[model samples]
Target: MGYEGEEIEGYYCLLIAILGNFDASEARFLYEYGPDHPVCQKILKKRPPPVNLAKMSKEEINQCMYRLFEEGYSKRSIADLFSCYPSTVNRRLTIGKKQDAEKKMEERRNQNNAQTDRCPEELCRGKP
Candidate 1:
C-alpha cells in the first residue's frame, strides 16, 4: 500500500501473471521482495510449464535475499520490510555487515590521512 501508484499496478500484474490469483498479502509480499531478484529474473525468463508462484522454493527466496544484501540493504531493514526476522536477513549476507563496516572505516582512515598529508604549499598558496 505504501508503494507508489504505478509500482502497485506493476506488482499486481507481475504476480498475477506469474503466480495466478494471489491474495493481497501474497501480492504485497512479492511486490516488496520479489522483483529485481536475480533468481526471479532467471525463473521468470525460463519458467517451467504451468508456472506456479505459490510453489516458490526456499532456494528462490534465498537467492532473493542474496540479491537484496548485495544491494546494501541492512539485515534488520530487510527483515522489517519483508516481514521476516533479522536472523533470516543475517543468514543471507555471507560477507556480513562487519566486513562492510570495517572496509568503510579503513577507507575513511585513508582519506583522513591523505587529507593530512597535503603539502603546506598547497594549503597556504593563494589562487593566482
Candidate 2:
C-alpha cells in the first residue's frame, strides 16, 4: 500500500529527528518541494527515535543533564528535551555542583589525614 501525504510528512519529521538538523534551508526545501520530491525520498525512510528524553529515571536524568552540560547545551535546552521547567534543571545543576564540591573536600581531608597518619611524629614536631 502507498503512503498518504500525512504519513510521508511524519516520516520527514522522523528523519529530521535522526538527522538532528532541521535548518531553515531544509525546511524551505521540504515545504517548497514536498516530501514526495526526489530530494525528500531519503527522508521517507523510517528511523528509530533519536533520543527518548521523556520518561527518564532520576539517574538517567542526572546523567543526561551532565552530558548535555558538558556538550554546551543550555539549561533551557536541556529542560525542553526532558520536558521539564528550566528552573528544575538549574536547581539540579546547582545541587550537583554542591555535591561535587563536598566530595572533593572530603577527598582532600582524607588525603591530609593519611599524610598525618604516615608522619605523626613529624606533624607533631610542627614548624621549627
Candidate 3:
C-alpha cells in the first residue's frame, strides 16, 4: 500500500508505453503507423495536475528544475509547471546538458548545502 515516487513514475511510463504507439521492437510499428489513433480518456485519471507554487526559494526551484531536466523534460514545459517564462527556466539551468547520476548528486549536494533549513544537518551527512 506504500507506493514510492519511482514506482508512480514507472506506472506513468507504463501508461505511456501501453498506448502501443511507439516503435515496435522489430521496427514494424513505424512502417505501419498512422498519425491518428484511438485514445482512452481514463488513462490520465490518476495524474495530478500542477499545484500553485508555494514560497519556494531559488535553490528549491532550481532543485526541481534540475531533477525534471535530468528526466528529459523541455525547458518550456518545465517553466509551465513552475508557472514561469521559458527564458527564466533557461537562465536557471546553467548546465548545458543532461548530467550523469554522480554529477547530479554532487549538484544536489552543493545546492542543498545552502539550504540547511530545508535539508537538515543529518541529511547533509547522508544519514536518513
Scored by TM-score, the top model is 2
TM-score of 2: 0.48
Cα lDDT for residue 65, candidate 2 = 74
Candidate 2 residue 63 C-alpha distance from true site, Å: 6.6
Residue 118, model 2: lDDT of 66
Stretches off by above 4 angstroms in model 2 are 1-14, 17-67, 120-128
Best by lDDT: 2
User: How many clashes in each structure?
Assistant: 0, 0, 0
TM-score for all models, in order of appearance: 0.33, 0.48, 0.37
Candidate 3 per-residue lDDT over residues 44-98, each given as its tens digit: 2222245446877766677667767766667866776777899888877763333
Ranking by lDDT: 2, 1, 3
In model 2, the worst 10-residue window by lDDT is 41-50
User: Of the pair 1 and 3, which is ahead by TM-score?
Assistant: 3
Model 2 lDDT per residue over 71-118, tens place: 667786667666689999887777666666787899999998887676
By the TM-score metric, which is better: model 2 or model 3?
2
The residue ranges of model 3 lying beyond 4 angstroms of the native Cα positions read: 1-52, 95-128
Model 1, span 41-81: residue lDDT tens: 54344322232336667555565555566666556645654
Cα error, residue 87 of model 1, in Å, equals 2.8
